[model samples]
Target: MGLLRKAARAMLSLSLATRPAVADTEIDKHSVDVAATARAFAQAAPLAIGDSYDYAPGVQGEADAEGRIGDTDFKLRLFGAWDAQDEERRYADIRQASLHWRHDRLSLGAGVGTFFWGVSESINVVNVLNQADLRQAVDSKEKMGQTFVSLGLRFGNGELSLFYLPTFREREFPERPAFGLPVSQRALFETPDKGGDIALRGLFYAGDLEAGLGYFKGTRRSPLLIRRSPTATEWTPFYIETENLLLDALYLLHEATLKLEAKTGRELDQGFFAANVGIEYPVYSLPGGIQELSLIAEYLVDDRGERAETLGQNDLFIGLRTSFGDIGNSSFRGVVSYDFDSQGNYLDLGLEHRLSDYFRFETRALVFLNAGRDDNWLYPVRNEDFIEFKLHYSF
Candidate 1:
């Protein structure tokens, strides 16, 4: 680790001298702190065994089964497949680490090891949000100060936060853009990634419900970026980083959203201002498990704008997922959503089972039928399939 730091500093010195000089825009103090943070996380992790350990290794895997019989989360499943494109990939990730602390209402965390970065393709845009990407910040595990910090705070129902986070909300592959956006859960976003800016959020109670509103500069204050120009046209393609400056507000009336996972699909990069609002209502109650359900919906609207990539059409859809049990955890989940004036419809089902106290399995499948008849806006449509067999380990 020490050697890597020396090499990185040597490399940075040479690179910094070549950049066009903008003293006012220089990153002197910030760079120093970033370097320090990276170094601190790379030092070897202490194991309970002993201090004499040299090398360490581990593996992760999942397997599942389904027969259209629903228990808690799925209504129906045609078939389940192992090594499915959606579940497992070639290069499964190895190790991960994070220096996170949460006490009272204040929280601070930063990761320094390689881990998971969610997908960004067509079908996944609505479901996948930002996760973690430590490898993108490091020159190597040995390079100290190779990671980034995320500081978050909560004052009552309101909160403030900042960090160099990567969010691949919407993506379009120039070549073969129709693929269910094959993304490996194990890979990190490309290096030299970007971060978010000053964000403020507040909460309140209305009648018998809870809700909130929030906004952030997105990237308005980012030092490395000066302007945001997203073009939504067929010839060019306006790609908004989803990390840009914009306003996002939500008011979720909480009730029966327990143990439920829903999905929606659309694009929201660049000038697209996306917003989501939701409320859940409990329908029934039982003995072993309580039968509960919730409804949800979200939208992304991009008014007439520059034509650089895709058509500036509004995308609106709604979905629902429900589970049953005394703890609000059921073995079944069902979802259905529709798109208007553009493409087709979507249906997704999921089921979970407890094989034993130490073993469990989950099954999931999704179908994206012909949603777009003409597809002038490139609304993707195909009989896409996915399944998951997850085995979890608890301490």
Candidate 2:
């Protein structure tokens, strides 16, 4: 980690020194934020495979640097994690190393970056830019950076952006099986190695309404696992070409917000559609300036139903978040996702509070109910419920 930090600082210094300075611009305005976190987990039940451990521990470090030279801005971010129990869980990623320049209404950028699309919290059907970092968590929030070139033009009420991705990143997986599944073998791509994916997006704002339309033609970020042989137990990831159209919108009403995200696409020879609609309402200064409460609900639907590889198919997600306005800046969140047909559900509880200027702590518990049901995605890890604690320090 020390070497990594030094190398990143050296690279940033070299880049800044080579850039042309501007008289009116703050060329020396550069800052780096680094954080180190340690985590420990306590499993309610033993894992179905491997050592069947009831406890595990891990540590991770992250660094983000941002700066500007004249009219161009640059950013660099790095992350790495280590796990004692699973070798595959120990990995590193250059989540972002990109540069952008803008003049008038035109903007251009190139390098490794992360792009996210969608409005719903439960399921982001339209987010297909970067590969998932499954080793980090199952929430699908963490992603690997993608190499690409992007161009954008701003309009009076909206903007149009085009992305040309010249490369693809394979999804990350852990060595130990979690959801009652076998460890997959190497990945196999149906398209050429030099993935030439393209995406175009248009976003418009009208008063309280915001909407976006997007299209993508590229190698799918999620893979279809196929058995190696009829009798083999191993599976291999097969990346397929896909063409997808996506729509997302948000409307603000009083203290409530409406969110919707939908996608229709063709992968290989199969056609599918998925949609998610959600609403969030927040009450500020609950009981007079001590706390705030937010209510959230969302419904997810997928045409593929049982055949869908992801979660949130015919499911309802309900969440409650509470913020205690105090010096420590404490917060509490609870979410439940219930599958309508399979009678399966998931529960997550999280709490976090700041300890000091440079330290913070968080704890989360995940519970799977009716996970053994045949039609439930959690059937793979019926006994994988666990609680995790994390401590973080920022510098």
Winning model by TM-score: 2
Q: Write one digit per residue (lDDT tens) for candidate 1, span 1-395.
A: 44234334433443343332333232211100000010111122232112312122222332222121111110111111122121221222212223334557766544332221111111221221232211221101111122334566777645665544322222212111122232222222223233332333344444543333333333221011112224311222222323323222223335433121112222233244332323334455434554555454544343422221222134454555566555544567665545555555555566766555555555555555455645433343242223333444422
Question: Residue 62 error for model 2, in Å?
Answer: 0.9
Could you say which candidate leads in lDDT? 2
**TM-scores, all models, native as reference:** 0.48, 0.88
Worst 10 residues of 2 by lDDT: 29-38
Which regions of candidate 1 are displaced past 4 Å? 1-88, 92-96, 101-108, 112-147, 154-157, 165-271, 285-290, 295-320, 325-329, 376-383, 390-395
Residue pairs in steric clash, candidate 2?
A: 179-380, 179-381, 180-380
lDDT of 1 at 393: 40
lDDT of 1: 0.32
TM-score of 1: 0.48
Per-residue C-alpha lDDT of model 2 across residues 1-395, encoded as one tens digit per residue: 44234335543554464464655345343333343433344453343336656666878778877777566777778788887777777888888877677779988777678888888766788888888888876666678877777889999999999998877777766743365556465788886753778999999999999999999998888776667788866557788888889899999998899999988988768899989999999977467444778899999998876546466688899998887756428988898998887778888789988888778788887777666466646776556566777787877
